[model samples]
Target: MTHRISCELAEAPLAPGEVAIVGAGPGDPGLLTLRALSLLEQADCLVFDRLVSREVLALASPKARRFYVGKASRCHALTQEQTNALLVRLAGEGRRVVRLKGGDPYIFGRGGEEGEVLIAHGIRFRVVPGITSAQGCAAYGGFPLTHRDHAQSVTFVTGHRKGDGELILDWSALAVPHHTAVFYMGLANAGTISRQLQAHGLPASHPVALVERGTTPEQRRVITCLGELVATIAREGLTPPTLIVVGEVVRLADTLAQPAAQVAILAEGEIRDRVGERVAL
Candidate 1:
């Protein structure tokens, strides 16, 4: 059971004052790339968000300077402006900084905004992409974003906004079948999300999956129809780090899953083989 967790691909040199915007992946240390972990090994300063798991943080060098600038709904440890300034300041100090975000940096992780600051300040940076929670959670929750028979395309959207602003999503359009919707940073809007979808012509019985802290030991998944999702999550008392998925694909978890105890063994062998073959299409 001694699987190699990391590789020798990156122990290379950095371009002196380079600052890399790396994703920590969806709260799973195993999903991190060799390059990312290697960078963390040498990072002089580590700036991470609250969504970054402590497990991943432990992998950084003991000498690294840790800065927790975590941000999310209900908790904004650092303002957007502050984060931008922090990145510029960190780079100015000639520190090898790693901006670790949960999930993919490019997927609603506000990475573009930070990149803009780096460009303005003439800081050399590279983006190391990681798995977004939507994609990660879907796979772990046994729901594919797109199954040939279930969907042709998948769209990821944020269901809520700052300042309690009304959602600007085109509900009538979004409610249509055949397209899967993945919502990130949407824990507080479960009720509204469900009601809006229903008002917009989506059937009340449309399948939905809510995955909390997905891909980790504490992961919780609720499979329900559109009619009861909001109420169900409330009843179950699930908290943040939740991702919502709506589509026929949510109905496939049981069908896609093997018996409970065989998952790890399956993941090491037949599961990947079968999925790899199927994915080749």
Candidate 2:
């Protein structure tokens, strides 16, 4: 099977001894940018994260060497230091390397830290932006991040805590009305998130949307209130990789959601099954 991509801006090749830190988007291969695809096809060494979908990886050249450096809550295949060293070493060997991260590399993907390492070692690299999980989950989960009547501002927050420590954040600012707050990797801190927002100013009845494995065939979206976030997760058996969106904008999902179940069925049945067949020729 042979495939060719035609684009006027495809002339810039991945030069040897350079690294391309590319975002793999939020699970969906179709969400990948053309520049990201180009680099994947040209990469000789691919370093990828856990959240990066296998479908996106399948689009890469089969000849490329793959290294999985996925990091989950408290479980890491490779330490951040080791991953940094690996990238530096690979680029030093004159390899066209691609560091594939889930969602936008700059949006809490640790691409900035990696970029700093590359710069310190004088390694040439480029960053290709992809759709962040907040955007992907919000769109696919059938809600707008911001609406004229619901929310006027949107904020992205990290839900990760340090060794079970308290989540230190500006609850006063976050609890303001007419603003949407999206928490990444926040499933574990649902109780704290709910409490803090209410303690500051927001009501317990604030609408919250829990999107599990968002933008994928297995995606699940649950609408609840801030007070019930913790209980909702337990009841629904939700896990990590879930996003928590807190705002009135989530109410729109009742009328706007395209039915996550149907979307999953179509993605698994038609899209996933036929993507290779259509693109292989």
TM-score of 1: 0.87
Candidate models: Cα lDDT each: 0.79, 0.87
Q: Model 2 over residues 91-184: C-alpha lDDT tens digits? A: 9999999999999999999999999999999999999999999998888877899999999999999999878788998889899999999999
Name model 1 segments beyond 4 Å from true.
1-12, 259-281
Cα displacement (angstroms), candidate 2, residue 251, comes to 0.6
> What TM-score, computed on C-alpha atoms, does each candidate reach?
0.87, 0.92
Put down candidate 1 lDDT per residue, 20-88, tens digits, no spaces.
Answer: 898999876777877888788778888898888887898888898998898767678889899889888
Clashes of 2: 0
- The best candidate by TM-score is 2
